[model samples]
Target: MNSVLINGITMTYDDTGGGSDSAGSVLLLVHGHPFDRTMWRPQQGAAPGHRVVTPDLRGYGGTQVVPGLTPLSTFAADLAGLLDHLGVRRAVLCGLSMGGQIVLEFHRLFPDRVAGLVLADTFAQGETEQGRKERNDRADRLLRDGMSGYAHEVLDSMVSPATVADRPEVAAHVLGMMLAAPPEGAAAALRGRAERPDYTATLPTVAVPTLVVVGSDDVFTPVADAVFLHDRIPGSRLAVIEGAGHLPNLERPAAFNDALAGLLATVRESARDGADMTES
Candidate 1:
């Protein structure tokens, strides 16, 4: 893990260390709530000849844990700061769930810095009153009971029943991530997430090549949400991984990687077209 001073904290990340500034050159993977950079380990080498950077958000993994609310905007800003620190001018951002929302926020705030976008198992709409209450209540419960019970309860939902039955190792990895997450960090994230703004308007404005992916069985943010995103984002591609759940990248890494590979190919083609036009 590479540590850097970004946005006043010692942010930690994994960087593959070398790649050019060409299309699909830099891939930044953002992990979702209650998980850290290691969640992206399977994807680090998926994109050959690219720099794959995975970072732990403010309160997760090896990063400094600030025991208070940390907004999505703050997370986005930390990513931008990290890019600056690494001398990267632009990157293709890939995120899942809460991480996807943070990627949207990053695009909203720093559109010029985004070369492409990959949003998986996430929705664009803001929270409803009931949803907000549930998240806050969950936050309180986590602070009170810690993560063990919550991790146990959510395990089946995070992955699918089939995954737990057949892929015990993947299930264990998911559970381990949840159990290892700092309660304070997870609580603050829940509180902040409860206040998230709708990215409904942000989708249509995406000018870069985008890919919207979801597990067909995702209960948190279903395949319908991915279709909704695909419908809104002009020229975006939608991929539904069959038989997987919220975390398809983990439940079905091969399919997810194939979808991502397709997106990277599209991005490269677009870049080449642009360069040819400039050269002409």
Candidate 2:
């Protein structure tokens, strides 16, 4: 894990040193609402040779929050700044839920900087203005009420029943992470979600290699949402992680990692073929 300043926000991040073939491109993992970069650790550990960059996101983890800045578009700009700071020319993006929204927004802002995309448990369009406000209101309430008060209720929606019963530690770890979030962090994430752009219109515009993955039992972002993204994003592939829920990376780490590795392979192969075509 490391730190860098982007858009005046001190962003905290971790990079998995890529394997032999990971040099030319990087994998940037964006976490969901209320979750820090640690959410991607299980998947990062499983995928070797891929330079994985996990940012705690503004207002999450150790990231220094920028005051007076609001709106979700700034978050996308923040990502572009991070890539510039790291000297990443172009990279593959793997983001979950809120993280997925970040990628979509970034693509709109910095399309040329992205090599490919992997959207997991995410959506392009959701939340009416009222829905957004209600969610934000609840998050504020939880932050004030102590995360533990809501953590138990959230677990059922986060992980599959099997994981909760079979992998209690997994649930506990996720719960702990949620509980540790500061009130400001939680509020900032809620605000970001509220201001997220409707990316459904941009789906067909994404021309890079792509993958849309989700757990079969993801209640927050259902399977239908993944299917919608797959059908809309030109040339993108879709994978349904079985026996998993919202947090598949934690609940089914192996499968999540494998899906990521596969997305990388597709991107690499595409790049290689494009080079050959240019040479010819």
Candidate 3:
């Protein structure tokens, strides 16, 4: 566990020291909304040959939450600052759900710093008017009733029925993460998320290699969303983890890690090819 001051907020992150003997090839893992860096524990030590970093986004985990709506751009900038502070010039950015939107914003703002992208269980569309209203309503409810009730309410939707019945431990873990989240921070994020721009126009412009992953049973962001991304992002690969839900990385770590490992290999190969072209 490490902390850095980014944009005047203390951001908490974990870095598994440069996992490879190579250079400028870190894997930055960004967690989803209402969840902290702990969600990435299943992936820790999984990327043996590449440095893997998991950071708690502002207002989650040990990080300090800023008052008011913190836009996705702010989250992107904070990540850029964290990379700068770590002396990393470029990295493969992997994000899930809201984290995926933040990655898109990061690519929009600092494309040069991104080597590749892994978007899991997330979509490129912004919230519709009804979606915005629903999020606001949920935010208000969270502020009023608190995390305990809200966590339980969303658990079924977040994970599959199989997970809830067969994997009680995983369900408990997810609930715990949600319950521990700061209500104000969650509310602020919901509001900020409601305003996120649609990435439909931006996806076609993504020049880097991308991997679109989804759980077969993901109710929030279904496999259809993954297909949408795979079709839009040039040369992107799509991997669907069967019998899993939104948080496939946690529910089925082995399958998710395998997909990630494949993406990392593609990224490395692409980098090598570019370097060869440069020398030629």
Candidate 4:
């Protein structure tokens, strides 16, 4: 992993070496909450010929943890800074769960920087008052009891009973990520996320090719949410990985990678067509 100073924090990231003019487009993977960039290990080789860069958010993984409210906007800004540092003018942004929301926020703030979007297991609506309270309450509990109990409690729902029973290693990796997350970082993210804006309006405005993916058995943000995104984002594709839960990329890496590959092909083709027109 490489390190760079972004927004007063030493942000850490892994960049699979590739040139700017490479045939593959730059793919940026943003991790979900209570998880780090390592969650993307399965996808490191998925985008063949592309530069896949995975970064730990400000507080998670090896990145510097600032124990305070870190809004999705802040996370988005950190990404923009990282891209600028890497000399990347634009990228195909792929994110899951909370990471998905961060990608949307990044598009909202820096639309020109996004070449395409891959939103997985995430929603666009704002939190209800009750939901906000629950998130803050959960943050408090995490601060009090730490992440072990919380991670254990939600393990099944995060993945699925089938995954836990069948794919023990995948289950272990998910649990390990949750348990290893810095409680302060996770809590602060929760607090800030509770105040997140409604991105429902943002969906129809998406100009680039987009893909909305969800686990068939996801409880947090189910197939319905993915459909809503796909329906609204003009021409966006939707894929539901069967027998998987919230973290489909981990539970069904092959299927998840297939969906990403399809989207990447679309992006690459579009880029080539645009370049041809410009040259003509």
Cα lDDT computed for each candidate against the true fold: 0.92, 0.82, 0.90, 0.92
Instruction: Give the clash count for model 2.
Output: 2
Q: Write the per-residue lDDT of candidate 2 for residues 213-257, one digit (tens) a residue.
A: 999999999999999999999999899999999988899988888
Q: In model 4, what lDDT does residue 141 have? A: 94
In candidate 1, which residue ranges exceed 4 Å CA deviation?
Answer: none
Per-candidate TM equals: 0.98, 0.94, 0.97, 0.98
**By lDDT, is 2 or 3 better?**
3
- For model 3, the stretches where C-alpha displacement exceeds 4 angstroms are 20-24
Better of 2 and 4 by TM-score: 4
- Displacement of residue 54 (Cα, Å) in model 1 is 0.3
TM-score of 3: 0.97
Per-residue lDDT of model 1, residues 1-280, tens digit only: 7899998899999988466866668899999989999989889989987888899999999999988788899999999999999888889999999999999999999999998999999999999999999999998998899999999999898998878888999999999999999999999999999999999988889999999999988998988899989999999999999989999999999999999999887888888888899999
TM-score of 2: 0.94
Candidate 3 RMSD computed on C-alpha atoms after optimal superposition onto the true structure: 1.3
Give the lowest summed-lDDT range of ten residues in model 3. Answer: 16-25
* Superposed model 2: Cα runs more than 4 Å off: 19-24, 66-70
What is residue 221's positional error in candidate 3, in angstroms?
0.5
Question: Which of candidates 1 and 2 is the stronger one according to lDDT?
Answer: 1
Writing each residue's lDDT as its tens digit, candidate 4 over 21-129 gives 3333899999998999999999998887789999999889999988878899999999999988988889999999999999999999999888899999999999999
Q: How many clashing pairs does model 4 include?
A: 0
